[model samples]
Target: MQSLMRVVRSASALWPFYLAVVLFSSVVAGLGMAAPFIIREATDTIVDTVSYGTPAPTRTIVFLALALFAAEAASAVFSNVSGYLGDVMVARIRQILSTRYYAKLLALPQRYFDNQITGTIIARLDRSIANVTQFIQSFANSFLPMLLQVAAVLAVTTYYYWPLTILLLLLFPLYTWLTALTSRRWQKLERRKNAEIDAANGRFAEVIGQVKVTKSYVAEVRELDSFGTHYGETVALTRPQSRWWHSMDSVRGTAMTAIFLGIYLILFLRTLHGHLTIGEMVMLLQMVTMTRQPVHMMSWIVDSAQRAVAGSRDYFRVMDETVEPTANRELVAAIETTGAPELTVIQHSPLDAREPVIGFEHVTFEYSPGEPVLRDVTFRAREGEKIALVGESGGGKSTVVNLLLGLYPVEQGRLTVCGRDVADLGVEDLRASTGVVFQDSTLFSGTIRDNIAYGKPDATDEEIIEVAQRANAHDFILKFKDGYDTVIGERGVRLSGGQRQRIAVARAMLKDAPILVLDEATSALDTKAERAVQAGLDELMKNRTTIMIAHRLSTIADVDTIITLRDGRIDEVGSPAELASSGGIYSELLRLTASSSAADRARLKAFGFRVRDDEAKDS
Candidate 1:
């Protein structure tokens, strides 16, 4: 209830419209009560005229009919205006909620995203918010107006017969209690139904995202069978949901009928005893029949209310999540000191002259308690240096890069970027100093130019073209009829692996940040493609501190320094020649790659490492 009220209060900016709705609803309620009263008056006039053997009060009938028509006409105009204003109010509410929800998504920690799949997060955010909107609409169109109508009806009816009003007042609580009890069960079912629906959406999104793989393997029938099973579960749950809904409707209808009959019987008895006039009896009967409609509508109203409450709880759960640690005092101090735009590159020198451009000092970290992914790790990248981190999978190469990016806060020792403690620098400021390219690059659904210019949103056409040429993307981009304007489907699916990498490199190059990180950037491409994309990467790496992570040792052979990691610890650190002479972990890894390729074997021979076929073929 409080959540619903909070949503309502958020639209306080549109209070003028809300006030109009309330005023118009009151008028409609007044007009609704007038019709029954007018009928009672007409009936009384006719009864009196007949009893006295006098002429009918035709003038009085005509006047009452005119007043009823006038009331209805006025009510119609006000109701129309109220409905229009209600729509405007709800639209504004949706806009406010959507903006806040999206901002919250941006502020949330990356760990939150890592724990949830893209489809699941999208499903929950979209569905939960939609539920809130539906509730708001339902409340405006049905719930509030019905309450007003009920109050008006009761006030007029009670004025005519105080004793019967007392009886109704006694029964109203019973009706409310029954509806609340039934609605409690429905609320549980509603939550279950929403969960099933979100799960189905998540699965559908995941499968469709990999449709090419599914088709390649000829798993169409198998996928359909899996989806059909999920559909069956949804329908099964819906059946029980529908059953409960009907049960509530049944109870409401039967109870309403019984109450109406009891009210009528008492009214009929009182009329016989002359305690109630014939006209009063007729008015009470009409009002009792009118009460049935709102009473029937009550079941639906309660159900909507329950579903809204459940959804609001879920929506606010995400909204209430603690944001990333970038909200700390050190970040605030960094922001205040620079006074630079969030995305603007800072050119200031290091706080400490001895500190490297990027450094990790005894950094120990873990995603969960007591299961460290990195331990006693220390490394440095001097300005304009090209460093390579070569390691087996899960050897913490990416974690080190992630720490430098400030995606997660350091729980152990200190990490510095651009000679500033990452914990003390604003996240956007940290990001502003670096550009990155990953193995699986992400491109939004937009034109080629849009993807390339994403980092530098205000880049001129000439600048975009220059960077694209530097990254080797301009020539291929022009092959499409629309050139840079050509729409790249979601995640640049229209482009090949090499083409996507080039575009990603172009984007990073355009940013022109002083630090660059390339994480397995060419690992996904074929040899021909890798050679083509690597040229672009080389251009982007020039005059910047480059941090490269790759399983392919050949890719980093020319790097200034090579750091080999084993079991989350730095096992060896040296130049390619130095590590090769030492015959350490880096040397062994190079030999492993050389054993599989003639070209790599030739390169290894120059480094004085031999790959014996007997050793490679050993059981």
Candidate 2:
């Protein structure tokens, strides 16, 4: 009940529309009450005329018929108008809820997404919003008017005959108590059902996204069986749940039938004994019948309310989560105040050449307790220096990037970007000052031009073309026959791996931030393409503070400093030449690369590695 009320309170902005709906519904209810009395009057008049053996009062009968018709017609018209208002209010509430949900998602930390499935998150939003909206509409159009009608019926029935009113009053409490008994168990089952559905939807999305992997393994039947098992479990739960609900409903139904039967018997006996007029008995019966409709609908309202309560609980669970702090206020204000917000980029004061562009001091971090991904790690990148991080998989290379961008909070030691503590800096400011090219080359389904200029949405065609040329993507883009306008499909699926990587590189280049982080930025490219893009990157790195991760040892040879990681601790940090002779992780990797196959050596040579004649011949 509290959760249901919270759903209503959340839409307080639409209260005026709700007010209108209630007012219109009140008119419909009042008119509905008039019909019973009008029928009773006409019935008594016809009986009197026949008993007296008088001429038929045709005009009087016609007048009463027209009054009845007018009342019914007005009731229908008002009911429709109220329904329309209810629909409008539901739409507005849906918009408000959906916008809030989306905004909350955007403000949540990266770790929240790490443990949640994309499809499950989406399913919860869709289902919760849908149920809440349905309930709101039902309450406005059916529930409110039902209550009003019941109250009017009770008042009218009590005025004419208190016995029938007593029976009607007793029925409500008994019916409600039985429903309450079943609801607790029914709601529990509904929650279980929702969990299963959410999981199934999550898996469905995962399968569709990775259909290629499933097909390669020929595990279609396996996936289908797994998917069906979730729904099957829900069905298993539903059997007993349905039985319990219907069993209680049957009991409530019997109770109602017995009470109404007694009320009818009393009405008939009273009319026969002259304690009541025929007209009075008829009016009371009509009013009691009117109450029956609401009584029958009570069960449906309870069922719907239960579903709504469950959904609202789910909705508020997300709403109650702590959101990350607001983005850079100054930047936001500038954008808000500017006439051309797209053209405005917040500029910070320049740092001295001697100051570190990035600094980490004994930083230790973990995604889970007692399982650190980075342990007491320290590193520094000075302004205008190109630093490279080289390590095996799961050595916290990506975590370092994630922390620097403020995707995850730094928990143990001090980390600073541009001399400002990362914890003190707004995530938007930290990210706005840095450009990143991730390993996956994530791209949206859009034109080549759109993807390239994604980082700088206001980028001109000439600027986009320049970066594309630097990334060695211009020639391939033109060959698509649409130049830059060709749609690349989702995540650049239509493009080759190398082509996608180049576009990603161009995006980062277009961002033109002071600091650049590249996580295997050129890993997908061929030897020739890598060399060309590497040259372009080298030129771009001249006056920028660049940090990169490279598995290919040859690629980092030209960097000013190399930070080698082994088991999350910095194994060595020195210039490339110094590390080559340090006999550490970097030196070991160099030896292994030097002794690799001919094709590997040739690839290394393309990145300006010195391949010895003996080592080349051995390969």
Task: Indicate which candidate wins on lDDT.
Answer: 2
Model 2: what TM-score? 0.90
Give the clash total for candidate 2. 0
RMSD, each candidate, Å? Answer: 5.5, 4.8
Tens digits of per-residue lDDT, candidate 2, 1-619, equal 8987776677676778979998999999999988888888888888888888888888888998999999999999999999999998888888777766776677777888999999899989999999888988998988888788889988877887887789999989999999989998999999999999999999998898878899999999999999999999999999998999889989999999999999999999989998877777887888888888888888888888888888899988987776666444543332222121223454543333336789999999999999999999998888888999877677788889988888889999999888888787777767877888776888999899999988677789999999898877888888998889999998899987778878887887887778888878776666766676676677566678999988565567679999988778898999998988899877766765656677765545443334444533443
Write down the RMSD of candidate 2 (Cα, Å): 4.8
The C-alpha TM-scores of every prediction are 0.89, 0.90
Give model 1's TM-score versus the native structure.
Answer: 0.89
Worst 10-residue lDDT window for candidate 1 reads 333-342
* Best TM-score among the predictions, by candidate number: 2
Write candidate 1's Cα lDDT for 198-281 as tens digits: 777787788799899899999988978877776777788878878977887678677767777778889899899998778888
Candidate 2 segments whose C-alpha is farther than 4 A from its true place:
326-354, 524-542, 596-619
**Model 2 residue pairs with clashes:** none
Local distance difference test, candidate 2: 0.82
What's the lDDT for residue 597 in model 2?
72
